[model samples]
Target chain A: MYVSMRKLIQLATVAFATLVAGASLAADKGLTFGMLMVGPYNDHGWSQSHYEGGQYVEKKMPGSKMIYIDKVNPADRPGLTIPMVVDDLVEKGATVIVGNSDDMKDGMREAAQMHPDIKFIHISGDDVLTGKAPANLSNLMGRMVYGKMMSGYVAALSSKTGKIGYLGPLINEETRRLAVASYLGARYAWTEVLKKPLADLKFQVSWIGFWFNIPGVTADPTQVARNFFDTGYDVVLSGIDTVEATTVAEQMRKEGADVYSVPQDYIGSCETAPASCLGVPYYNWGPDYVKLFSAMQTGNWKPTWTWSGPDWTDINNPDSSAIGFVKGSALNAENAASLDQFIQGLGDGSISLFSGPLNLQDGSVYLKAGETASDKQIWYLEQLLEGMDGASK
Target chain B: MRMQGLKRHLFEIGLILGMVVLFTTLLLSLVGASPLEAFSHLFAGSLGSWAKFSRVLNVWIPLTLCSIGLLYAFRTGLWNIGVEGQVVMGAIGATAVLRLGLEASHPLFYLLAALLMGMAFAALWALFAGWLKVRGGVHEIFAGLGLNFVAMGFVLWVIFGPWKRDGIASMSGTQPFPLELWFPSLPGWRVSPFALGLTLAIILLTAWVLYRSRIGLNLDAVGRNPRAVRLFGLSPSRYMLLAIMVSGALAGLAGGLQVTGIYHRLIPSISSGYGYLGLLVVMLANFRLAPVPFIALFFAALNVGSIQLPMMMQLDSSLAGVIQGACVLSALLVFGLRTLRKRGPSDE
Candidate 1:
């Protein structure tokens, strides 16, 4: 028995040595892009949108392949850092890597410094703007504020109750700005469009602490949505990355409650509960990904922060738009017509909700009369607007 | 007689290995993957180059430390399931010190101080569990498990509250420490040499303390028969507390290294489940110290290599965890069979 065990060990050692030699002999042959996703690729929300964008890249560019690892967050893949995965991807001959999470800012920066030759695209980061990123790294995000505004517009148009709830993710500049944008749209629809008294409308925001639920880590979105519905908030605009708002709305409607939801992120999010979904403000990353990858391939890529907005000529044009909203089955004909008019006004610059006499949640002056918010002001919004309820910091 | 004992040991090991391979291969085939290709990918992904091997070493370092720590607690017959909480407290303590030294000079001094504070914190946490067991008569397992939840809650609160970034309340953790505060490594190396040296020193010290000293004998006696140990003028409770504190110190050191060496910030999961993995490693080593490091290296390699499964084969990386579970189950089965054979069916 002892002799056989010794022989077995020797044989295993030789096999492993040969395998190592074989691995080194293999070489890269094509343009490979590596994608790291914070959630599962099939999650039908944030990560899936990025995964589909990678798939779009493969179809558009010949001889290019995508290698992706999803669920890249610390909770799901503990002990796996961005640099470690980047090392593996580089070994596999990837020239471009996309990290699809704001949580990856530090690790992506570290990995970008480690591999200056490889180009890195970190979505929803300000590293490039902040001058903290290396020259090889860039940032990309859709102007989702417009989409969220449209989402709020539709929700306010279709609601029977004037109370609207915003189911928010963690408190950050990005989420804060988005939530505020939704509130602006809802307020516009409630007062100017519907001719309702300003005191009759109620808007509140509830944050669940993270991008998505991790069981015990984040508050369950389903429960939060149910609370919104049970409390006479007839419409809930989801600022999270999942379809839990629509799903809960559908469950509530079945029990004879009239509630509507607008899910965020991927276009197909409403398919989970189409009857209750008012619309989805989704990201169309394909066109931007193709443009960026083409620039990288032609060696004309300069690291820049790109916050692309939807094509005004056709917001839902899959071939052109970076951000788009799709109306769900629940939107009534009159509300849908009004929503189209609202979109037209936004596209033509005839309406600007950010112009005011605006006060922050603390009643401090945010914008004076006839004063408009600049891009920086909108991007770094410090508090929820007056008449909104939620934690700001 | 010595030759027969060695042969039996070899036979038991072979049986365990064979069972693990068979079970894993069956799982691969069931998933419609070629077993040979999967095995090769796992091996090549982990050991294909120096860079990859260094990553495996990075995982092995902490895992081995925790396993060695577990050895001390096990010697005194304490479950010490609270090792996970101890690791978190250690990370919290290390981060507290590192945060203070963010702008301080002589980063090396701060780094050393952080490690010692981490150890002190973890030792105190472990001592609480020991106290509950020795004085309050609460089972260490329950005390440890409950404390683990509290530790988790505390880390979450720290990340989302006081340590949050300027305007960000995120689970991504505090802003990273400066590069100077990071555990120094060579230009091309992924693992810090200082961490490697410290781990090696700890292993040697543990071996001496657990095998070559009078304290080792007393702890072993306490484990086997605490009442008898008291008759020998040795306080079993004292030895139990001492063993648990030492275990906590080592686990804490692992957490400290994870911060200064690996993560550079206090992420919510800074411990990376290494504490539980250590429990498995020590158990699979059959409560012995000799095989602990080897088993830890194997587990670490599996962890590092499993990344290849997702990238190359579109297979779930959890297969590595499944393989690990199979190995431990197979070891338990082999040991059970050996005991059954020794008793010649009369025990049944």
Candidate 2:
């Protein structure tokens, strides 16, 4: 028995040595980037866009691999923290790590401080601009306000009841600004394009307190959407990270309601309910990710807050555009043409909805007459604009 | 005879381990993964290097603390289902103290004060349940479960209202405390030695308190026969409340450590479900204090290592939970079989 134990010990030592050698060999191969997604990879919304962007990076840069772990939220994977997962990714030979959520701000900041040698990219975070990020940490986000404007424009064009509902996720600066942008576009379409009085149009926002449903935690997005359709609202624009608004609109349409919905974030969000989808204002993160990853690979990367805008030459160009609006099959030709005009006006700087005479919900002047708001003013919009219904704080 | 008993005990443990391995292997094969690769990945992910092992220890700290606390309640035949809420309250209490001491001179004093406040708050929360059970005759399970929901709602309100970050109300939770308020750890160490040392000392104290003292005997007597314990002039209700309060105090300490040592902030999921996971650990340890620490360590290793399954094999990390469940079921089966063998055919 003692001789057999010694033989087993010898065999284990040989196996361990072989495993270590193989691991070291694998480590020398290529550049591996790690992605931490806040939702499932195939959620067909925000997280899916980021996941596909990672895929794009692998295809664009040869010998560069992408390793990702999704559903990195506390509700999904309890007891797991950002720094803990970052350590695992680094151990797997990932030189650059991307965290794709604003909710990951503190954790990413902590992890960035912990690993000064590795590059960290936090999406939709202001840490870099706020001067709170380490030298190795950068922030990346698309100018989604423009996309939300298009969504509101289309929702207004498609609405029969002249009432539009916004399905907002949480009441932060990002959600508030996006919701306001959508309302501005809708009001512009109602007053300027359709030649209707502003008072006849009803624009309201309902926040679910999170990007997605957490059952007992957040207010259910599905129920919130149904409540919108059950009321006189003929159009609902989803500002959350999921397709619940579109799905609910489809279900309500089947019940013979003349309702339409516009989903946000992913390019393919319209596919969930094509007949009811007016259009989707999606973030095409591929071009931005490729640019950043390439810079990191070539060692020319510097930490900067990138808020990329769409390529006006061709908004749907996958290689150039950071944001695009895909017109759904439900959009009539006449309205679609008008929508194209609105897009052209936006692209050429002919339309600037943020120019004000704008008042906040509390009757405070946000911008003086003929005064175009600065980037900081727009980015840190504290309250909903007047004529929009929602809790600002 | 003693040697034979020891041999039988070892055999039962071996049988349980074999069943767990067989069950997990079957599960991996059903998912089209190589069982050997999966097992090796699990081992390497948890115990590969010092960094990984330190993370596992971080998980083990709270888990073992909760498990040891559950032992006190279990000894008195109390089902402390409110341990989860108690942990949350403890975190809230700690955060309250830490928030006040954000700019204080001595960080260590505030840290100690925060942990004590955490323990005090959790003990009060547990005592309310005990009071309802002893006085109002409400079942402890129902009261505990109801309080869990209340605690959840209370935490959400606190996070989104009074404790929210300036100009931001989010589920991401309150603003993170500054690094100065963080529980100090040694360089290159993820797990705080102070937290680890405290947990070890608590475990030793609990073992002594529950097994080697008169209070321990009285608690056991109360659990076994409350009516007969009255002859000893001891109040069973008081003992019950005392046991649960002690249990809450320790669970609260776990929460305090999670805030100060791990998160350094009051997040919505501060407990990380360690309270519930501790229940599982205590159950799998067969409600024995001696095996509680080891079982918690194993579970913690599984929780930490399962991240590799998703990264390497494209498998959901819930497989770790499945393995945990299988081990508990297999141990129960072996335990049943052992009892049957000892009873003989005539006993039935």
Expressed as tens digits, the lDDT of each residue in B91-136 for candidate 1 is: 9999999999988988999999999999999999999999999999
Q: Provide the lDDT at B285 for model 2.
A: 72
Q: What does the i-RMS of model 2 come to?
A: 1.4
Off by over 4 Å in 2: A1-29, B1-20, B317-321, B324-348
- Per-prediction DockQ, in order? 0.49, 0.49
Checking candidate 2 for backbone clashes, the offending pairs are: none
- State the lDDT of candidate 2 residue by residue for A1-393, as single tens digits: 999999999999999999998976565447799999998888889999999998888888777788899889887777788999999899888999999998999999999999998999999998989999999999999988999999999889889899999998888898899999999999999999999999999999998888888887788999999999999999999999999989999988888999999999999999878789999988888888888877876678899899999998888999999999999988899999998999999999999989889999999999889999888888889999999998998
TM-score per candidate for chain A alone: 0.91, 0.92
| Clash totals, every prediction | 0, 0
Error of 2 at A22 (Å): 20
Per-model TM-score, in order, reads 0.93, 0.93
lDDT of 1 at A371: 96
Give one digit per residue, the lDDT tens place, for model 1 in A319-377: 89999999888898889999999989989999888888999989999999999998778
